[model samples]
Target: MLPKHDVCGEPLYTPKIIFKEQGETKYETTDPYVWCRKCKKYVEVEVTQK
Candidate 1:
């Protein structure tokens, strides 16, 4: 999912690559939390493929 601003209306930190899996197919997963500088905490989010 594309990163979006936090609830405080501040831009979130860039999504971090958590891991990469390789098997029949190769895909990388990103961290579910979007860090907010103003909030000083993480906002949970779900990543999905369009």
Candidate 2:
């Protein structure tokens, strides 16, 4: 999960999963978005794999 703020430090909420990709390796990539109350829209977020 990313920080509580977006690029411009706007509060984020309701993380929604957009899609998932399977790579050749064991790691799986996922794309998600969060609702930005300030912008009144959804913004992409970075997810770190462990």
For residues 1-50, could you state the per-residue lDDT of candidate 2 as single tens digits?
Answer: 34566457875664544444456545433546777777777787766545
Cα shift from native, residue 16, model 2 (Å):
4.4
Query: Residue 12's C-alpha lDDT in candidate 2?
Result: 64
* Leading candidate by lDDT: 1
The global C-alpha lDDT for each of the candidates, from Candidate 1 onward, is 0.70, 0.61
Q: Supply the TM-score for candidate 1.
A: 0.55
Residue 45, candidate 1: Cα error in Å is: 2.9
Candidate 2, superposed: residue stretches over 4 Å from native: 1-7, 14-31
Q: Which residue pairs in candidate 2 collide?
A: none
The true-structure Cα RMSD of candidate 2 reads 5.0
Worst 10 residues of 1 by lDDT: 1-10
Query: In candidate 1, what are the lDDT values of residues 1-50, reduced to their tens digit?
Result: 34666476776666678656677676778787877778888898666555
- TM-score per prediction, in order, is 0.55, 0.46
